[model samples]
Target chain A: EAGVVQSPRYKIIEKKQPVAFWCNPISGHNTLYWYRQNLGQGPELLIRYENEEAVDDSQLPKDRFSAERLKGVDSTLKIQPAELGDSAVYLCASSLDLGRNTEAFFGQGTRLTVV
Target chain B: SQQGEEDPQALSIQEGENATMNCSYKTSINNLQWYRQNSGRGLVHLILIRSNEREKHSGRLRVTLDTSKKSSSLLITASRAADTASYFCATDSNTPLVFGKGTRLSVIA
Candidate 1:
């Protein structure tokens, strides 16, 4: 079985430009997540979805960041008018559910560089 | 706010030696999991220890959790160069799993 997959392993864009990242989760997984990791910090959850419903997304920056999981199998994270501070690795993961015992599979991540 | 933090930001050890990394979290957790990341690649799940459990072993990896201390430790015995990577501990609750800063381990051959 294939693991979680992400597009554009690396991305570079100028500030104020819009950028988007895509993710395709493992088959049969019921939960998906978007996380941002800075240079020396751990990943911070940006949003989480169970099927077509976004169960958690309080950490997402509503002003510039938006995410959607139309069918719940694939997700897209978008940042409009990106800022330098938006540069980081965006990781996507999936699990059977949000259960504590479920192990999440991660993608290589899309590293974004905003100049 | 982040919930977990790993200690000893970096560690260097020789092959065949033992490497231990620690993690502490602020709130109650249903389970704690350890993951390893090589270079800039995705993370691989190493082990998971449930709150009802205190210890778990997977090959050369061992994880111990203390709910009262709100801490967990990962021990890699007889480490090899292949073990060189960043180790992160994630705490799971009803909320999303929160990861720690991670401990970078370098195993010299």
Candidate 2:
């Protein structure tokens, strides 16, 4: 089975511009997650979806960051008026379920560079 | 706040030697998982050890979890150059998995 798939392996945009990243979870996966990883740091959870509902998104910056998962299969994370600090690798992951034993598989994250 | 923290930010070892990385988390967790990521790529799941369990093994990788101490350790035996990557430990606590600042392992051939 294919792992989580993300589009635009790398993206470069100027500050104050809007940017969006896309993700397609693995088939039959019921849980999806978006995470941001900065240089020399671990990934921080941005949002999580259980099916079409965003069950957890407290860490998401509501002011400029928004995310949506339509039909519970694909997801999109958008950042409006991006800032230089917004540059990082956005990773999308999926798991069969939210069960404790399930393992999440990640995509080749979209690295964003805000100039 | 990040839940997990890995020790020895970086490690360098020769092939055929053993590599050990440690991780500690703050709160209770259902399970802990280890993942490896090559530079500029996504993370690959390596192993998952449930809370009730103390030890789990996969091929050359051995994971030990200590719920009492909220810590875990990963041991890679007979390492190879291909094993050079950043290894992260994630704690799943009913919410999304929270990762640690991974340990970068460099296996020299």
Candidate 3:
């Protein structure tokens, strides 16, 4: 099977500009996740989706970040009015199920650079 | 705040040497997973050890999870330069996986 796929491997935008990243999870996977990784740091979970519904998004920056998985297969993460601090890698991952033991598959993240 | 913390911010070793990294978490976790990230790329899942599993071996990789100490260790024997990457430990909570600051390992051939 194909691995998870993401679009626009790299993105650059000015401060206050808007940017978006897309991800297509593995086939038949029921769980998707978006994460942010600052330079030299581990990824931080931004949101998680079980099917089309977001099961966890408490860490998402509500003021400018929004995500959706309308069809439960692909997901999009958006950042509006991007800030300098927003420069980081945006990663998307998926797992077969939301159970405690399933392994997640990741895509080659979108590296967002805000100037 | 992150639930897991990995030791040795960076490590460099010659190829064929054994590499070991440690991780400690704050809360109880259902399972612990290890991931590898190449430069300028996304993460790849390496291994997962449930809280109930004490040790597991896959090829040259060995993982040990100590629930009582809230810690885990990953050992790669006879490592090769291809194994150079950032290694991260993640905690599987009820929600998403909580990750720790990774250990950057460089294997010199």
Candidate 4:
């Protein structure tokens, strides 16, 4: 089966502009996650979805960052009025279910550069 | 704040040698997983060890978890150049997985 898929592997935009990233998880997967990774650092969870419901999104920056999983099969992460500090890799991951033991598979990620 | 921390931020070794990476975490965890990420790529799951499990192996990869010490170690035997990548350890409790800074391993051929 194909792994998780993400579009626009690389994106460059000016500060104060808006950017969006898309993710398509593996078939039959019921859980999806969005994470951000700064250079030389590990990924930090921004939001998590179990089906169409966002179970955890406390880490997301409400002022500029927004995410949605309308159909529960795919997701979109958007950042409006992007700032210079918002430049980082946005990673999307999925798992078979919300089970604690299930392993999550990740996409290639979209590298967003804000200048 | 990050819950886990990996030691020896970077390592370099020749092919056919063994590579070992260690991870230490604060707070209790239900399970710990190891993942490998090539430069500019997404992470790939390597192995997962439960809190009650001591050791598990998958082909050339071996993982050991010590819940009492709140630490885990990954061993790759007879390493090859293809094994060069950043290895991250993630700890999961009742919440989402928390990752460490990761260790970058370079297996020179």
For each candidate, the alpha-carbon lDDT, in order, equals 0.92, 0.94, 0.92, 0.93
Which regions of candidate 4 are displaced past 4 Å? none
Lowest summed lDDT over 10 consecutive residues: which window, candidate 4 chain B? B90-99
Q: Which candidate number maximizes DockQ? A: 2
The alpha-carbon deviation from the true structure for residue A57 of candidate 1, after best TM-score superposition, in angstroms, is 0.7
lDDT for each residue of candidate 2 in A82-110, tens digit (9 for 90 to 100): 99999999999999888368889999999
TM, every model: 0.98, 0.98, 0.98, 0.98
lDDT score for candidate 1 against the true structure: 0.92
Write candidate 1's Cα lDDT for B1-109 as tens digits. 5788999899999999999999999999999999899989988888889999999999999899999999999999999999999999999986867899999999999
Model 2 pairs whose backbones collide = none
What's the true lDDT of residue B40 in model 3? 92
- Supply candidate 4's per-residue lDDT for A17: 98
lDDT of 4 at B100: 93
Docking class of 2: high
Model 2 has a DockQ score of 0.83
Candidate 2 segments whose C-alpha is farther than 4 A from its true place:
none
The lDDT, on a scale of 0 to 1, for candidate 2 is 0.94
DockQ of 1: 0.80
In angstroms, the error of model 4 at B76 is 0.7
